[model samples]
Target: MHVPHHPAFPKAPRLPAASLPLALAIPLLLTACGQKPGEAGHGMMMPPTEVSIVTVTPKEVPIEFEYVGQIAGSREVEVRSRVSGLIEKRLFTEGNRIKAGQALYQIDPAPFAAQLAAAEADEAMAKARLAQAERDLTRLKPLIEAKATSQKEADDATSAVDIAKAALKAAEARRTAAKLDMDHAVVTAPMDGVIGKTLKEQGSLVSAQGDSLLATMAQTNPAHVQFGVAEAEQGRVQQELASGELKLADKGFNVKVLLSNGSVYRETGHLDFSDYKADPATGTYAARASLANPDGKLAPGQFVRVLLMGASRPAALVVPQRSVLEGPTGKYVYVVGKGKDGNPAAEPRPVVVGDWVRLDGEVKNGWVIKQGLKAGDQVIVDGVARIFMPGTPVKPVAAGAQSAPPAPAAKS
Candidate 1:
């Protein structure tokens, strides 16, 4: 074959076998590089991304705060022996509900009984001596008045009577103490509660001075939930309340509990107490809620999640938490607005968020927008990943709606 070549175009050198494959691939690679994989050809533009959006509207939204809490009894008491003695028997079953004044342990009463008997005998002897002193004084009074006995003798008899009276009082006091000790030998529950295991076993010697703890009991009815609020969080809430951004219920917060199994407690509670001083250990203010636990479902020392309700944000703007993105400047959200060409576009809008809130009838949480957003602004809730850059044109679709087809590709 005859080929003509001009001086301006040089003849190509022959490639080796290995280099020939690469040489042949150069043209195909150049053709592939000229057009994007998904594009029909060069200069064809990609369709606008489809995104789900929520319209911003000012409405009263209920706000809830959650904290890690623990279940506790309204009253916890340590069962101890009031008198020193050996534990004769365990009267109450371990881990059982007990009533106030119910006998829990029977301490050895033999020694107490013996002491009481001795006191009674001493009291009886004192009574006899007192009677004799009174009789002698009575006899001396008449004798002295009739001049049958000396005045000194009558005075001595009266002194003896006074001494006897003092002795009697001392004996009576001892006897009463002995009787009380005898009664205390039987240890009883101080309040109605669920009793824990006995600390002192049978035949264990317990004393009032030390080692007196026999068991522990806690009142389960009207169960109390103890939780802490961080000092920073408290301050933030106060500021919000002061600015009229948050409104609390007139009564107080209505509390609900989340069990470990992820179920809500049947009974609701109310805020009973909140400490003014911060806890030294936790740097949080202590708060408590009281709930009716008639069925004894709540146990002491159980961990739970506390939900504090009865607060709401009035006429506030909110968006899904996922919609808020953190950029180099601050937190922002993509808002669907009209571009210069009158097409829908995603624009980055900086926002100041106050608190995380769960909307009514919604499971997921949302951010309460404090600033930089107004009512009727369309905020993109989903498909934000598709927005590669600010001011990217988008197809706005209502949340939970069928997505519209992508705009037809622009003709080259």
Candidate 2:
């Protein structure tokens, strides 16, 4: 048989059976031991994850205490009828601002007027009697000196004159009282303020001692915010003040009022009043702040939030709230630290948190770390959830990037 050798088909050299198996196993061994060109030892190593971090810097932060408050008039006055009469007319409009001594209601003056006229008539009659008695005494004095009248008659005449004088004085006193009743028939505002709805309407019978309620007026220009603080907290504040740890401005404790609509009031207020003792039932101390409310924007009974300032936390360690995590045991945070190999790793750190600090009036950004954290520690703020386990390698980047710098520790 003639065998043709082609360029594409190369002839294989024949080998012994045992040696052939070894030759075939050589390629298998090389394929099993060799690594791909792009691959490194073992396998490709993943790069550290990029994360946002906030550096913990201890600084002086203002300690702000917020309490729910109720708005009220600085001065509240209850309008009442001073004399009994029929309400003739409502002099002031409801919900209108009124001035002190402004007429609020007109009561019927017919009865009071009649009483004054009767008193005047009595006074007139008493004066006529007094004049007659005086003329009699004048006649008696001359008669007694002339011996035409008995001494007892002169004495009786003098006594009658004195009695007449006393009666006239009593009549005058009654007239004055009647005049006062007439004046009091008209109810007036006690202080300048907005008047509430009329309690006694027209044609209703009102009296000074009976059902005298007419209306209510409140001075709103300088509004008051009433709030209560836990007695324990107040005691702590007082202790701090005594220790000279907290200092107040010349005007005293400054207060900020936050409206229910989440807007801050323009004018600040001052703490003017505080109850001497804590309420036994509530365990709180009552307090009040006076704020300027010329525009009448703050209404009585309006709910608000009052923030007390002027105290500070010295060297407070604060971090962004986003860096905190809730675990099975308690709250924890990831701190950027060097791992075993000197690579940056996320280390789980337990921390005790304090009150929240609002960076802007609208949103809360950072919170106080009372324990387990110190100054100059890099805390992972963003990309915390990306880390599945502690000691995971990470690349730290500053938070807020170019848009905003790290949130500063708030003073108040």
Candidate 3:
């Protein structure tokens, strides 16, 4: 009896041996399998994680391509001297508005006037010589016909008359040259616009392109705005130009200047020209627009932002950027799918992206799957990182989605 009892019972005491291991293992197993109140063994256990999210929405934002640019007016011209002379007097006010052909500077005309007087005196002397020669020839011709004068005498008189005529022609040419030189003494405005600072004042000798720029005039009546566009976008712009949809080409985009104080200008501009070739350095084609600047609101060398309308793509699929993941392959996003039980499940969707519109990316070829999502579907916009893992459970909350009771449907 002792031997039999000892064989089974001698291994360990009932509670002591088993209790130690049980106490140690029980807690660990419980902790490893522990979950929510009723989620044990249900695979609902989770680890803490962080997430980012974005929502899909449509907004009427301008299709804007932004670039840093300098403020430039339509008119810019450099005034230069047409002839070399001294700046005897500054007739126009510095930085004042001047019209074309308006007298701006006066050069001393004394030298030119003296040249003209000398030409006139030469002309009178030549005329007097011609008169004397004509009388000699007339008398010689009659005497020669009567044999009172020799043939040689009449021929000599004829030659003298020809010389006097030649002298008269030379004097007339000098007079015309002198008049042209006199006109150069007065510098006039080549274009009607505002004149810049006086580079040379009274008594300053300003030779052709010397250290002097008397003044500069820029025609501001209709000003210009120069800009560029990418070659890829040129086709769309050209199409808009041909169609009545845009009235003007890509440059024909309705341009409105926003001043420093955020005030809108009253005038509008039109596309004036487009370059035939693209710039090799930038690969953008040049374009220019003309705007009426009657009030001189637009100034040269100022910085401004341009808003342009591009080709519109209707029926475009879009998704918030936060939903997209940059995997080893490319950009992708998760879509919420419903299981047979209608419980939400997540599935990774690959998408081809296009121009970003605010926080959204234009999705193409992604519309093939119709059931999971739609254009206006409310996707996660915040806390996406917390739920971004494949098949990860999420406590979804919209950016502005507030907790509300589910609405009850009316009885049909």
Candidate 4:
């Protein structure tokens, strides 16, 4: 049959199947021969990883504990009025340091003054009556003795004198009470302290029965720093105390105050009070330290840190904090050990760590090694993440050195 010449069919002629296989094999042979000597078919061998190591050192580390605390006044009292009256004027500036008996507020004294005046008038009347009764008695007594007056008259005069004396005494007592009330109208500070804002302003009615709080005052010098100690720590401290490992003054342990900004207070403090019982809610015991704050730098209710000092460990194994690693079994550190062919390898050593020693403002310097480490052992401080196995080969270098790069290829 006559068929139309299609463009796709008239394109080209195919080669022999045997020759096709030979052509593909030629390219494969060239690729295989082009490979460099001693090279792997897939990937190249990686050089040993470089790591930093630190030799373990035993030190006499000072044992200290830090706890959050708050500053408070050594003595704090609420200023209140003793009598019911209207506040006439503010007598002291807010937040000003004051001495004991310093006037803080003035209540209206007009009513109290009038009451005192009435009491004085009554006392004067009583005195006049007493004088008259005494004169009558004197005259009646002589008259009765001389038979000029009856015995009943002399007895009545004596009774009148006694009544007059009682009246005078009562009037004088009232007068004293009135004077006290007048003096109380002027509110004064109970102790030397810094006064807070006045709660009741001028023209406000105040009373003694309700204990109207006029203001608050606090003695902040020698400030009281209040803190809480965990129950576990408290027990440990007691145990150490009994063992004579820690020595404390008669008052208590000496402490250092660290402000929130990481500055140490100029003055040292002494622990004065500790609760006998632990708080059930927080499992802590309330404690207080008295710190000298003559400049009033520490104020009431200021948050701070308290560092318990004056204790230490004679021999403590420590390592750079960076060497510590957390694993399934707990904390561990990579220690350099001899491997096959005398090559160095990383071996994991389990460790128990205590509190950290800070360098500058909370920066970690090293860790207190409680267990699983000894002096002179080398610990991997850097490049720990690259270690996949316990016996992985590593090139040890001094801590803080930069890892050298891979060597260049050898010249042909």
Which pairs clash in model 2? none
Candidate order by decreasing TM-score: 2, 1, 4, 3
**Model 4 lDDT on a 0 to 1 scale:** 0.84
Q: Which lDDT values do the candidates have, in the order given?
A: 0.88, 0.85, 0.63, 0.84
* Stretches > 4 Å off in candidate 4: 1-59, 141-151, 239-251, 327-329, 340-346, 358-364, 375-412
Candidate that beats the other on lDDT, 1 or 2, i.e. the better one: 1
Q: Please give the clash total of every predicted structure, in order.
A: 0, 0, 10, 0
Residue 353 lDDT in model 2? 92
Ten residues in sequence with the least summed lDDT for candidate 4 = 3-12
Q: Over the stretch 158-277, how does candidate 3's per-residue lDDT look in tens digits? A: 999999999999998998888877887888888788888888877887676565466677776776666788888887657844663323334335665556665555787655677999
> Model 2: per-residue lDDT, tens digit, 1-412?
4445422222445788989888777566555768443344452456687799889997776678899999999989889888988999998889999988888888999999999999999999999999999998987777788999888898899999999999999999999999999999888888889999988889999868879988888899899999999988888888976876545555667999999889999999989999999899999999999999999999999999999877776667888877787766678888999988899998888888986876455577778898888888999998876776667799898887733444787698
TM-score of each: 0.77, 0.79, 0.60, 0.74
Query: Number of the top candidate by TM-score?
Result: 2
Rank by lDDT, descending?
Answer: 1, 2, 4, 3
Can you write out model 4's per-residue Cα lDDT over 1-412, one digit (the tens) per residue? Answer: 4334432123224678978988677557656777554354544444567899988887666567889999999999999999999999998889989999988889999999999999999999999999999999887876788999887888899999999999999999999999999999998889998888889998999989995998999999889999999999989878976876545555446889988788889899888898999999999999999988888889898999998776655567878888887765588888999877578998788899986875235555888888889999999988887876666789999987776666898899
The TM-score, computed over Cα atoms with residue i paired to residue i, of candidate 3 is: 0.60
* Alpha carbon deviation, residue 192, candidate 1 (Å): 0.7
